[model samples]
Target: MARPKLQDVAARAGVSVTTVSRVLNNRGYLSDELRARVNAAIAELGYRPDGIARSLIGRKSGLVGVIVPSVADPFFGELVAAIENTLADRGYKALLCDCQENAEREGEYLELLQANRVDGIITSTHNRGVSGYERAELPIVAVDRRIAPGVPMVRGDNRAGGLLATRHLLARGSRAPIMITATDHAGNDRATAYREVLESEGLTPRVHAYGYATPIDERRAMVETWLSGRRRLRPARRLPPRRGGAAG
Candidate 1:
């Protein structure tokens, strides 16, 4: 069956199309009796307004785009969930896009979001330059990664956290603490903090940087090699025996 329209509701309500439109939009003052009649007619006809038509008329899509590296990652999954909940509270819908750590795919998703007339975008991936983002002409919030100069960003204090972690290890009698991380990461603030804390304590900081995009086997081999080298430099020390027995 054909769905009911505004004209059908107007005819059923015994009112002009203008009156029906005004009632639907709540534009002008309306008599209680007239409003009741229009609402009753709409209810009787089971009429539902077309969201796309309304969005086109209002020039707002009521959509917010969210682009992440990959939803498979727990961090990105949690981030997307938070964004979705916030958007839902604000009466906006989320258009989620996973770039899968591909720069070209990320750029394409950005264009797709733009073409869809999304009101804004929240991105956690910034592999490409700023030009792609600039062309979107929409409000953007960068997550963890800095984009263009004008773009706003939200990130944790990684450097402070790193410093705290290193200090804690040092206090616990960790003579040679090392940091392992991706080599091509956009920022090295954490590594800098780790180095600074180690240098302040008159200890050399050891860092092992690996390619994040490499195959799992290759990464495992690299890590194993680094660990073997470290073991050769400083063998594991035997702990003192406990009062009751040897410590497990």
Candidate 2:
């Protein structure tokens, strides 16, 4: 069976398609009597305009895209929940893209959002230097990640947060404070801030990288070597075992 169209609704309502379109678009220039007649015709036809099709025609979609590195972290979970609620309240639907720390995949998702004609993007991705995305024509707001030059960002001051954490640790009498950060760029920023603060206050900060090395065969060999060293460094049982579990 052929589906009904706006023309059908307009014909049924005894009005022009332009009038039907205006009512559909809420332009509200018509009398209440005509508006009610159009509404009745629309309801009787069980008609729903394809949202994507309509958006393409108007060049505007009430859709927002979001990209994040991972969703397992508590911080990201709360952020996603809040973003969804806020966007929902504003009559927009959110499309989420989880890149899982894959830069190429992140780039792919960004392009996908562009292809989908998302109205705006809220991203927490790290691959900010992709030329294709850098030149993309869309509204982008980076969240929880460093925004590249010419990109608008909405996030807490991470460098200041790092310094605050480091200073708090020092004030609490931490003789040796070590910061374990993952990414090279972000870690560098935090470490640089920590160093500047430490220098001003005659304190020193230690930083360490923590991650599993990759690339197949080389990674296996490195893991085996680390396991062997760990075994060798195990503390030896120096004294005889005590009879009681509580010890004398």
Candidate 3:
């Protein structure tokens, strides 16, 4: 079946195409009765405005691009979902790009978002080797990771968060508490906070570092290797070995 258009709604409402366009765009003040008639006609015809046409007229695509390292990750998945819902509430569409932590794919997605004329971008990608941000014309917000100098960054305070956990262990008399961190530069703040807190308490902090990109099996083995030597430590400060990662 042929799709209904603006003319069909105008014909059913007994109005001109210009009036129907105004009603759809909410351009100038419209009487209740006129609006009701137009709305009723739209409902009956099931008419939807052409997005491309509206964008061409207003010079606004009403689309926001969202790029993430991996939507499969729980943290990033929830982040993307929240962003999508917020944009939807504001009557903007989201163009999601999952780069899978690949620099090449991220760069391509950035170009594609610009090609689609997205109004703005929210990204968590590290953009390693990805260029063009220095010359990007549109607004870009980085989440949790620093992408560029001028781009605004939104992230949690690593010091405050580290204190929460480290303080908890200290209160529990976990004198043997140790810090495990990833090799990535993003984890430097947390590691620094951990070391400072331990040193201030006059406790020697034992820090074990590992690669974040290490295979899951190798990571497990590395953690196990560290825990194997825990018996030599004291009991009152014995903190149980827990599986966790700080690479995100």
Candidate 4:
């Protein structure tokens, strides 16, 4: 079946093609009832505007490329959700690319997004040394990590967060607090802050680097070893322990 076109929408709504175009572009004076009729017909027909043609004419794709390491991670899930919602609120669409923190895949996605002519890019990938972003000629912003030398970054105060977390654990009677973080550069500041806060309290700080490629079983064994050979914890077998008190 042929896809519905603007003429079909105009025919369905009993309006001129120019009038439909005006309504779509929000040009000229239009009645609320007439706009409702056009929209109702569009919804009934399930007709969508041709993004390519619109982009060619308007010089804007109305789309933004959003690249992330993994949406399955809780932090990333919330971040992507917020990004998509904010893009929709601004009348733009999100083209999400999940690279699973792989450098090659992230490079490919950068090329793909540029080829798609996305109006802008918002990336949270932890893949380092990928130079595709540096050469891109479009607007690019990073969240929580650096993509290139001059890229603007939007991140939280990791130092304050690390201090607050360490102090909280200490207050709760945690004698031994270890930070098991990924090898991402974004996490380096937190570890530094952790060491600083612990040293301030005359406590030793233990920071272990757990890369993303670590297998589940290997990670479990490593955690067990870190926790002073304690029997593996249940339910959270796959996660690292954040705080512990004298192995008790």
List TM-scores for all candidates, in order.
0.70, 0.71, 0.71, 0.73
Tell me the tens digit of each residue's lDDT in model 2 across 1-248: 67889999999999999999999888767899999999999999988877889789889888999887666544566788899999999999999987777778888988999999999999876654544556779988887665566788777777787778777876896544555554555435676766555555544544544321233465456556655664565332234323332111
Report, for every candidate in turn, its global Cα lDDT versus the true structure: 0.80, 0.72, 0.78, 0.81
Going through the candidates in the order shown, the clash numbers are: 0, 0, 0, 0
**In model 3, what is the error at residue 50, expressed in angstroms?**
1.4
lDDT tens string, model 4, 135-173?
Answer: 998999999887788999999987777778888888997
State model 3's lDDT. Answer: 0.78
lDDT of 1: 0.80
Candidate 3 positional error at 236, Å:
17
For model 4 the local lDDT of residue 65 reads: 96
Give the clashing residue pairs of candidate 1, or none. Answer: none
The best candidate by lDDT is: 4
In the range 51-155, model 1's lDDT, one tens digit per residue, is 768767877888999988767655678989999999999989999998877888888888988887889999988475535776568899999888778889999
